[model samples]
Target: MTKQQVNKVVLAYSGGLDTSAIVPWLKENYNCEVVAFVADVGQGADELAGVEEKAIASGASSCYVVDLKAQLVNDVIVPTLKTGALYEGQYLLGTAVARPVIAAAQVEIARKVGADALAHGCTGKGNDQVRFEAAFAALAPDLQVIAPWREWHLTSRPQLLAYLEERGIPCSASITKIYSRDANLWHISTEGGELEDPWNAPSSQVWCWTTEPEQAPDTAEHLSLSFHQGEWVGLNGEAIDPVSAIDTLNQIAGAHGVGRLDMVENRLVGMKSRGCYETPAGAVLYAALQGLESLVLDRSSQDYRIRLGHEFAQLLYDGRWFTPLREVMQVAAEKLAEPLTGEVVLKLYKGQITLTQKQSPNSLYSSAFATFDEDDVYHQHHAEGFIRLYSLASRIRALQQASATDPQSGGTS
Candidate 1:
């Protein structure tokens, strides 16, 4: 795309250091009017505060802050929960899933404001650049996508800071903050600093939304969670809103140090990066949902659900949220989730949530069939015939080996 033809550009801005620097960089390089777009996916009030002023001060013509918290939880998070999708078996894909929604919103804002180009602060080396670009390509193919990080001379944080400082852009950030952190209603992730090394343990400062295991209280807490068609509706029998329900779980689980993970995951850009994440609410919710699944789902159905969960996790992690595959997986997950209505009682201890009990109307577990005591429901001798058939191939292989080794047996036996 030619810079002379571009008049205006809409940016997916977070009011962060990179984004703040990108605003002025776009104006200087492309010579286009930059409009900043911020999506509020429950990161925090402090992050959202003074965003408009920050954008305008950073050389943006106008700033649009769209509230996406409700939509995020209801539309994206809940559907993902239905599949029990966890990226690499640990991450909740908080940042990964949020990108598509943010990008989609930016495209919408660009269309509304009559912008000719879309810009993002994602670096060329990261997974986010692929995610954002793929989303823009899928949603707004006509709009020229501008990635300053890929094109600009500004490389490191110090260089960007220097540029911003030279422009007299007042930012409330400093180099003293060691770790790069991202937080939403679901989870908080930390990268950089000590986390750069895989051997180094995560320090106390690494966690923001959750308490350290050692710092947690000794007393255990019991809470009941109720779900209907995969959506959580109540806590301890009290009906609550989605935000409040998740918030309550976070407080309850975080107090017990229930969710903390450290992993080096493969990025979409074919590089590995280490990150420490705290997902208290998400952990508790996953445990409760699995407990409900145990009660409701049959053997074959449960196996399929597990497979779908893995696929869904990969899709979400790879930022394929708006695609047909995502829609199909979500539909299947929703169908499976229909019988998942139930209540689960979980005991939250130091960094552990044990499912104490689970009850569902559609439960397949039968007390009579599971009893160890003598009952007419199951015959004790039935296992003998079943075991013989199950191990027939193994037994036949052993017999063949014995016959071949025998002195009296022929070589062709």
Candidate 2:
């Protein structure tokens, strides 16, 4: 295989087995200087710790760790939340939404370092490969993309470990690591191992971020969340920033086992894979926002939002974040969200989060009109005319059919 001519390449490094090996592999195969770029999207200190040192030791020229937590929550997560995107009707899109942000940052680093090419450790079979490459194509079409997984001969984890060992590269990954997990502030997803089989129920070993529902505390936990224009603004009446709010909710909700999901989801790569996900904060935030939307939005508007939510979910899942459709839909969502300001209380108990109370200053609910009790505000007889008009077309069709059937009234024969 003839390698493309390249001087330098920046790789999305995670200090993982695949990326650790990719650093040296790119250097060896392409003979290009590899500059590792790490996006700190709140994956945590343990994952980021020693990442730079590891990149350099893995034969990379240098590394740049960019803090993307704030951008991630504000630009990516919040915007997607506003659209109410739930991929496949359930997945919170924790991993999908982060890709464009990370990829764009990787491109920026590539250009800043004067690199001519970008590289990634994404496997060819997975959706992340398409996501990273699609963002790369959109952001920097001039720069060449080198995906090591598509090029490398190493097929499995053990093979990757052996390849590193053979090259004398230090990697902490072992064959015993069964589950492939991805974690950030929004959620954590665990795949592979027993989760690969849909028939097999996820064992206790599968869940890392939340407690087992059976073992959760006996007492239920209550929470009051405030939202302004589709964004979570306060917690328990105390003003909170988006980042702090998610972190606080994660701890509280995870303790109650309120956001754990186990199911098989369709991947954008034309495959279905089973996994377990924990979106503690996301579950609470979504519920609160939905409660507020119910209070503020009219019936027709709410139905439209539901359709838009499905479209946005597919768009985000397919990694089309940089496109114009996303911008248009986001603006529509923002407009719908304008009136979605209110407070909602939730009950978290035994892996369940339920909306207990909802209130908005702009609520369309009117007790006088809705109550069964006698009220001068609404006339009961007025509904007779409205119902007749509402079913006017059906009534006309029925009358025509009766006239056609009765020979005395109409000589159709």
Candidate 3:
């Protein structure tokens, strides 16, 4: 790649220590004007407040805090839920799926600001670098891509602290920062520190969004969730928007510590990393929607949908969200969710979500046909013929094997 004559650069700025440091570093190293682009994907106001001031203080020419909460829920979260795309059977893909939406908007900001280069604060060892760069290549291949962690000589925290101090940058960060955390409306994940050791149990200090399971209330709580074509529409018989619905569930579910997952998952970069996640709303939604799917989808369709979901999960985990295969699989998953107009009642108790009752307008379940008691709809004798035909090949194969081993019996033909 040729050296880019970068006059201005647009950066995906989170106003965190890494990105706060990146703004001035871009100016010093590339000698370019820096534009901070912050995507407001419902991470919360505390993280967003004073961000513009911080960006300017960090030597950015201007800052753009683009609101993407509605778009993210509609475009990314809902569609992902349709496919049941859980990474490695544990993760909800909260950060993995949120990257594409953030990157696409960053590209737009780069073009709007007339910046010739794109910069991100993702480190060399993580998967976000590939996610951001891959989306950049697909969206704006002409822009120069700069990842500071891959090129910077300052590898240690003490060096970064000294560099920031030299630049007169005020950061409320310390070398003793235990966990690396990322949060959005969907979930919050914690990595590094004690999490690096798989044998070490996650302490109470590691959890922020949820109550400890043992400390949860003694009595269980029941909540009803309604879904229409995979989008959560109602909660406890009240119509609510996607954002509000998720927030409500998060509050309710978190109180009971309904969503805490500690697992070691394989990253896209071929490394296994341990993390603890709190996904209160996501856990409830997954259980309720799956219950609805069981009521709606037929036997063969259910089988195929489960297989397709696993493939889609891999695509999402690997940061292939913008590809044609993602679109193809999403369309198929949407088709399977056409009958998912139902309400599911779930009991939340001590970090467990159990599907207690479910009712759907398009349910495939029939009590009359399934009853063990006498029913006019189904005859017991008919099953004998059905079983005989179903096992005919097995019966014939067994007889042939027996005759081959016993030549005297084969003489009768």
Candidate 4:
């Protein structure tokens, strides 16, 4: 494997500074034809606009801009909601979960164009390299993977800029750019810059998707979310697909600054990194579904699902979505989600989404059984027998101790 045997490569292009430089570098180093593939996972129109032109300008033979937003929301996001997967209890695994879908699409594009290899602009220390390469291995093991950052000698932003400049490549980015960001339909994550220092607070410049909590409106906004068999089919009583539903929630929740998190998280590559994330719509959805789970699932069932949810979230963050363990977890979650049909009312105000109320058609809640007042349904006398049987082992242990102390009945016993 000293030298790859690929003649053509499909590179995941983002139209960003690194990827823009990667287009020409792939050709110059590998001596292969380069095709740029961009997956539109609803990062936004601004990022996608003129992306093809930029790719071509960077020396790509051709550019393929495919829309992946619908698939991302319907296939990935909707199914994930059923599992209640939240990374490390709060992170939401935003970029981690979104990577598989994007990488899968990139692989598909490579196959369609008959490329012998794949390329990505992910840095050496980032988790995305493992995610993208793992998918390539699972889907197309024969194809080679060329990771520029891991192979090239360019160490700094200045060096990368110099390489692009030497090749006469056009790039607007400068050394002043301090942050690395990834945006999609679910969330937007910001890293580098001041975030690298955990002691430093995330300045206003670090945030974009969410309004400042203090700047949020004084009034709270209430909304109704409807779900059928675990899928969020309609928002605000209006029928909509998963993609539109996410957008609608993002708009509403973003307005109130409902989702903002600044934390030091452990990366899959075994590094602790600090970052800020804004997941406005995802926050509202999680609060709603968790409440719905409490209504539909029994105590024991809910407990097990929650335990499994934690594991599922961890696996997702580690980029093991294609593994058998992940499949098993997903299957179990889907079975539990069958009874999750309900409506939840949420109150959003200043970065907080409160579950005001929730009702499920298959709700296991029964006020009669749980009432503290006198009720004919549950006989008081029945509890005496039940308690005796339940604590029989404890009762036996106490009787043995009493017998041992009765020295009068049996001397020196």
Query: Which candidate leads in TM-score?
Result: 2
- Tell me the TM-score of model 3: 0.96
> How high is the CA lDDT of each candidate model?
0.89, 0.89, 0.89, 0.87
Q: Note the residue pairs that clash in candidate 3.
A: none
Candidate 4 regions exceeding 4 Å error are: 1-4, 374-377, 396-413
Candidate 3 residue lDDT tens string, 25-57: 999888889999999887889999899999999
Model 4 residue 327 distance off true place after TM-score fit, in angstroms = 1.9
True-vs-predicted CA distance for residue 392, candidate 1, Å: 3.5
Question: Stretches of candidate 2 above 4 Å error?
Answer: 1-4, 374-377, 411-413
Off by over 4 Å in 1: 373-377, 395-413
User: What lDDT tens digits, residue by residue, belong to model 2 across residues 1-413?
Assistant: 24658889999999999899898888888888999999998888999999999999999999999998889999989988888888878999888878988999999999899999999888888899888888988999999999888887988889989989999999888887889999888889999998888888898999888898889999999999888888888899999988867888999999998888887988888888887999999998888888888888999999999999999999988989889999999999999999888899999999998888999999998788789877888788888999999999999999988888889996474
lDDT of 4 by residue, 176-258 (tens): 78898899989999998988888898999999889998999999999998989988877878887778678778888998998
TM-score of model number 2: 0.97
Select the stronger candidate by lDDT from 1 and 4. 1
Worst 10-residue stretch by lDDT in candidate 2? 1-10
Q: Which pairs in model 2 have colliding backbones?
A: none
Candidate 4 lDDT score at position 381: 81
Clashes of each: 0, 0, 0, 0
| Candidate 2 displacement at residue 369 in angstroms | 2.0
Better of 3 and 4 by lDDT: 3
- Candidate 2: C-alpha RMSD to true structure equals 1.5
